[model samples]
Target: MQIQDLPYPDPGVPDAHSGPRFLWWLGRNQLGGQLKSLAWGLLHFTSVTGLPFCVGFAIQAVVDRSGARLALSGGLLALCGMLIALGDTFLHRAAVTNWITAAARVQQLLARKTAQLGSALTRRVAAGEIVAVSTGDVEKIGWFVEAVSRFTAAALSVVFVCVALVVYQPALGIVVAVGVPILALAVLPLLPRATRRADFQREKAGRATELASDTVAGLRVLRGIGGEELFLDRYRAASQEVRHAAVRSARMWALISGIQVLLPGLLLITVVWYGVGLARDDRITIGELVTVYSAVMLLSYPLRHFEEIAMAYSFSRPSAKRAARVLSLERATDTAGSLDASVPSGDMHDPATGLLVPAGRLTAVVCGDPDAAGRLAERLGGHAAEEASSDTSVRLGGVPLDELPLDSARTAVLVQDKDPVLLSGTLRELLDVPGSGDITPEEALAAAQCGDVLEALIQGSLDAADPMDARITERGRSLSGGQRQRLALARSLITDPEVLVLDEPTSAVDSHTEARIADGIRSLREGRTTVVFTSSPLLLDLADRVVLVHEGEVAAVGAHRELVHGEPRYRAVVTRETDEEAAASLGEVLDGGVVEGGLRDGVRDGGAAKHDPPKKDSHQSHGSKHGKPTLSDVLNELEEIEETA
Candidate 1:
């Protein structure tokens, strides 16, 4: 049958049934082409069978002194040879077309299923397994499907040849017919073992691919922590395991190959032995004996197909099962009712922590643990945790988050993550998310405090004209960390959802930039329900109110200043600049103490009453005299500490 006529297997069927059922389904769908190809192949096999008969006829004609019959038989044999060659060529062409089209259809189905699952696909299946299915599995499935037509044609040709032999010489024909089936069926028992080994080899290969992908993605982190050697050693071990599996698979195939060759050779020998006896007994003429022998020799070619089909199936079955598994992944769903036509209009609530973000107001979430804040954000955005006991329930307008239609829910509540994904695109294109409407690029950039980001774009020789059109590389690798974060923020602002949820939007920028972003966000997101999940003091101060999260629950809720004084955890979490800042501050305190001691020593040694002439000081004089030392002064003290050490 033509490959175009083959139907792709239904993805909903059980994987266990996919192998056999898929083959049957393909046959049923492409029956017309298959029958045509088979008919032509049979005619070719008949023409080939006539060759030996014509040769025998010529020999007998020469023996009987009939020159005309000998010449006619010779011409008939030549015509049969040409016809056989033509049939074989056409049959091969049709079969190959069948294979390629079937593979293409299956691949198309796989692509559709992948799109149907969308972002949820990776959560269900390993990315490497998906890669293996599309690249390796599709080809194997097509190989088997295409092999089916060729194999059938070959088997039919062998049958036609054997019948022609039996008609010419009964004794020789019976032997040839029985022996050919034996040769073809002999390899069936060995196939199970070969398929098992092949499955094991494919599994190992998939695992190695997964390990390699993971290694590449985390290579930067591995090098940063000096763990590259450790991961490389692990990958090396995985590679060795893959090699061992491949060797085992090859050994099984080798055994199958040996059987294919030996069985066919033995069948040829049996046919020759029987035909020689018949010729000596004078029951068959010398010419007929030669014809029978020739037919038996031709039958050996198709017998080899039996072994090839077996090997193709052995490799393809496991590949189909792997592809089936990926196609079978179900989309994620919430237990709550369907959310079609639901437009959330009130406060957003997180039941897990008793945190409520009132509608049309700016709210800041201050978490003692950033990890907890991140988890809260994920739940709020409708990404349900696999763990059953994760009792976090987020609601919009008093309706449970799980009840919302996935698309509508996502559109309504946009979660701009701390490390938001910056897909490869122009800056303007990145700002326009999936459902962004008429929001202007300039407004979005301004609201994000992206003036400096635009300046950088201008400085860089990007191919696009406008700063908005400047290309941002994959994952924003081309941009600095802060620039990427700001661009992500701009994208989020453009969406302008009913409830915009941002997790640490200003964490990467400088304090001045952070303040601007904080002010800009509040001004732009005027009437929407906005939840900023951050402990940044600048962002927190801009909020109408701050909710303090501790141990995955809301511990305190009030204004940012109120929480800072009342909640020590909130204060420690936000006010702690960094390790470098702490070290600098400690050095400054020590240096100040040394200076005070030096002044005290001078007073004691000079016998002064530790008094200085009071320089005409007003109310502002004392405050100015004892102003807090700047971070630069602290850094200088730290330099002294380092020098002394």
Candidate 2:
């Protein structure tokens, strides 16, 4: 595909064994682009090298007083100039295309990997490291990729110039050949130092970026706990460290640049001085001497490419390595499978937990531990199972999920984590996802209770557009927790996967709203198989079967009401605490014997007589049996009596 057709249909599998190998693999994929770039680059540099020869010949023709030869040299010079202009124009186009396409391909690969790994990707790699790789590191890798063609052309042109000079005049040729090699090699020792400094600067910058990311992600939490200043100070220090490292890295590059310039200039001076001596000694003609000097001057131009190529390699090597590292991370469930087989529609069973979710039924999983619940949901979706000690695996339709094609497994079961992120875009764009197309966006939104959310997006929008066209800020920061949850749920519902697993899908919403969302899920997904990992009674009550998972084992499996009554462990996890117990604990915390006379009767008697009998003690209180008076109520009654007196 052409560069314009970017975000390639497939980025192709990457060789992620090492950074250098990854880079080489990328080069091989874009061989055509690289070849075009090299051809244009060669044409450009060759004309530039030939320009000096034409000038020297013109000088000789002028010295001979031959108008014909002078005109010939002048015409040849103009032709070389025209070729240089033509070649340079297309050279940039080809080279930049290579750079952009390479970057786009890598971005696509990273995006695919991220989607494949899901929430587990961040756990394996720092969010900061990923940000660095996708953003800054991608460009660095592309920079090296594009630089290779230009460097190759420049080196070839320099070699051609040195050979022609030696054939024409050996005395000057030998000096130039020796000096050019020295000029290229002069900064080799210093390159290692510059690369180290650059790496340090990149590290500091990544740290600062990560700190800023964490701060922004938890801004609301920081404000709530008044830790904003503490983190702000930490980020400030990180930024300062980055600045210092950048300055040091820049200094090293500057010193290297200076050395490159000094050596080339020294060689030019030596060539000019030596050529003049040859002219005086009558060993070479004045035009030949002029040609030697002009050629040396031209050599300086391509020689600088050496320094540029060095810098590119130093930066790109590290970037490529990081990209490779991320690509190498595979799902624990990753295994071989035949592409020809169709995915089955059988029950999903996790052997580790011995939990079976029958096909075409809504199953509720109640796990006391939130972390364990999340892991279980991911396992059902064929995600991570790294620590499993058994040879058996999670199976769907009687086949191990790991042995199925990745895309097939993903399409069959979609596990929505506890907190799904909402990317910034218009409402329409946010909900536009690849799916079975069985459910419309409007239907999904209604099922997810997102009518209020849609209205709010439209009202808060700065632009005048249709309600669905209203834009959402990054991560839906403009929306409340419940609104974000509803919107994310809507997006997930629309996907219409065969086996949908939801982890606390309505935890952020109120009980009333949660009840509505639970109904919506059950009704909309009536015929589909779904597994919801939650302890909410509102949701569990609707499930066809509820599985009580305690300490990584299925303790009980039955209807919600049956489990709540028969299994004490399930009751404790779902109810948090019984109403009577909670009320007794709260009643005991009251003062002035309210717990003894009023609260105990109110809760235990289940709405007893209005008034409690007056107690004998001076500090004893009397109030409605169902409603105990608080300290503020007593204070207000006393104030009213004093005013009346």
Instruction: Name the candidate that leads on lDDT.
Output: 2
Could you give me the TM-score of model 1 versus the true structure?
A: 0.75
Worst lDDT run of 10 residues, candidate 1, spans 603-612
Candidate 1 residue-wise lDDT, 1-645, digit = tens? 344444555533333356666656555655666676677767666676667788888888888889899899989988998999998888777777766766776677678677555445766777777777788788888788777777787877777777776776778788877887887788778788888888888888888888887788788889889999998898899899989989998998898788878876787788778768877888877787777777766666667778778878878877877776776554344443465656677988887788889999999997767777877887777665554232455778877665676666777788877767888877767766664465666777888888988888867844756887777778888778778888888888888888889987876665566667888899888887899987655677679978988887888888876664455566545544343554454345545554354433322111111232222212123321112122333345435755796
Clashing pairs for model 2 are none
Models, CA RMSD each = 10.0, 7.9
Give lDDT tens digits, candidate 2, residues 254-362: 9999998898889989988898898999998888988888898888888888999999988888889889999999877566465435766878899989999999999
lDDT of each: 0.71, 0.82
